[model samples]
Target: MLKMKSTCERCRAALTLSEQAYICSYECTFCPDCTEALSQRCPNCQGDLVLRPPRTRSPTEAPSLGFKAKLEDFLYRA
Candidate 1:
């Protein structure tokens, strides 16, 4: 799964799930401003930065806690 990072790596700007962002193959995330500044290239890997797909899911929906949460719940119950 895409980590869907919440901030721009360069400027530390907040990036919402539905907002326009950019990423490279290595998932180096950036805001539109920074992306333009860098000429759509990933500073870390020197790869092309492309538009990240916006998440279509509603923001109000709760995020899953994944495997660690399940394991913790089971341990607590036991």
Candidate 2:
């Protein structure tokens, strides 16, 4: 399964399970807003931000949607 990371690399904003993030060649993931601000390209690889498949989570597993949560809980809160 793809690792569902919690934050955007550039802005360090939270990336939620529901939102789509652009993964670069190095697999660096960032939120759509960040991607757009970054010019729809990965600063590291200068690659495109295509829709990546959502990470598989079991029904019993609660996903940590940091961006979706209250802003205070995030490291670089969105």
Per-candidate TM-scores read 0.73, 0.59
lDDT of 2 by residue, 1-78 (tens): 466677988888887776678887667888888877888788887788766667555433875565654554664554
Which residue segments of model 1 deviate by more than 4 Å?
58-78
Candidates' RMSD to native: 4.0, 12.3
What's the lDDT for candidate 1? 0.92
Per-residue lDDT, model 2, residue 46, is: 77
Task: Give the lDDT of residue 33 in candidate 2.
Answer: 86
The 10-residue segment of model 2 with minimum total lDDT is: 69-78
Inter-residue clash pairs, candidate 2: none
Per-residue lDDT of candidate 1, residues 1-78 (tens digit): 786889999999999898999999999999999999999989999999999999977544656488977997999999
Clashing pairs in 1: none
